[model samples]
Target: MGQIQLQNIRVYAHHGCLKEETSIGSDYRVDLKVDAQLAKAAKSDDLADTVDYVHLNHIVKEEMATPSKLLEHVGQRIIQRIFKELSIVERVEVRVAKINPPIGGDVEAVAVVLSSSLPNFGNQ
Candidate 1:
């Protein structure tokens, strides 16, 4: 087993609860971690044997393009997509952050983190 991480993916998206936030949009950063069996890839050195980072980034970008009302919702969607699309992934962790959120205070960002594990379908 091994871990793969995609960190600090910057995206410009319109996602927030406020109307102004959705109209104006903001920068977002996404961090994702995946736990999977990497022994086959390590031995064979083949791309097919492991999860592709580029594909993961594409998925995140696609999800971010759609507007959502909350960071938690966005993060959950990302986690679900990773599990649904990536068959090799056993567990996934996703962090979604909105840069310079309008909270009426000096706040740099607001973030939501979500983690999920795939069920053992083989055993079932």
Candidate 2:
């Protein structure tokens, strides 16, 4: 198995509990990690054999375009989409961060992390 990491993807999106946040949006960052079997790609040196980072980026962007009430929901949707779209991916971890949240205090960012793995329901 091998891991692929896509870190610090910056996006301006409308995702928050507050009405102002959804209306104006905020700068956000996303980090994703995917675990998959990569022996074939390593040997063949072909993009088809591996999960393409560009495609992964597209997925993140598409999901981020949709507004959500919470960071947790946004992260969960991204992870679920990745697992559904990328058949080779066995597990995924996603982190969504809102930069300079509206907490009425000095804060750099607030983030939510979520992870999921495909379950072998039939095998068990």
Candidate 3:
């Protein structure tokens, strides 16, 4: 088992419990860790042998473009999408952050991290 990571993926999205946030939107960052078997890809050096990061990025963008109320929901949606679309992926870790949260305080960011592991089914 090996990992492929997409880090610091920045996007502007509408996601919050507050009405203003949902309407106006804000900057968000996402980090994704995908666990998959890399032996075939490594041996064959074929793009089709593993998950395509470009395609995943597009999927993430599509999901992020739609407004949501919670980071947890957004993160889960990403995880589910990866798991459903990429059979090679056995586990997913999604971290989403709101940069400069609207809370009236001095804080760097607020974020939610979620992870889900799927059955390998002897593929690895």
Candidate 4:
């Protein structure tokens, strides 16, 4: 198996339980990692044979663009989209972080990680 990681995907979006947060929005960081069979792509040297980072980045941006109450929800949506769009992906891990959040203290960020593996993944 091989891994493709897209890290530090920065974006501004509305995602919070507070009304002000949803209205004003906040800065976010997204990271994604996917596992897939890479032997074919390694030998073929063809884009079609590999997991596309552009597509994964697009998914993270698209999902993060939509407003959600929690980072976990956003993370799950990203994972779901990846698995749906990329059939070859055997597993996925997504991290969604809210930067300089509204919490009433000095905090750099808060994040949630969500991951899943395809059922019967070991059968291969």
What is the C-alpha lDDT profile of model 1 across 1-124, one tens digit per residue? 9999999999999999999989999999999999999999999999999999998999999999999999888887787788888899998889999999998999998889888888842231
Residue-level lDDT tens digits of model 3 in 17-57:
99999999999999999999999999999999988999778
Output the lDDT of residue 21, model 2: 96
What TM-score does each of the candidates earn?
Answer: 0.94, 0.94, 0.93, 0.95
lDDT per model vs. reference: 0.90, 0.90, 0.88, 0.91
Q: Global lDDT for candidate 2? A: 0.90
Candidate 4: regions farther than 4 A off: 120-124
Across residues 90-115, which tens digit of lDDT does each residue of candidate 4 receive? 99988899999998999999999888
The TM-score-based order of candidates, best leading, equals 4, 2, 1, 3
Candidate 2, 4-122: lDDT as tens digits: 99999999999888899999999999999999999999999999999999989999999999999988888877887887788999988899999999999999999998887778412
Enumerate clash totals for all models, in the order shown. 0, 0, 0, 0
Error at 118, model 3, angstroms: 0.7
Query: What is residue 13's positional error in candidate 4, in angstroms?
Result: 0.5
Clashing pairs in 2: none
Candidate 1 matches the true fold with a TM-score of 0.94
Write down the TM-score for model 4.
0.95
The reply for model 3, stretches above 4 Å from the true place, is 120-124
lDDT rank order: 4, 1, 2, 3
Question: What residue pairs clash in candidate 3, if any at all?
Answer: none
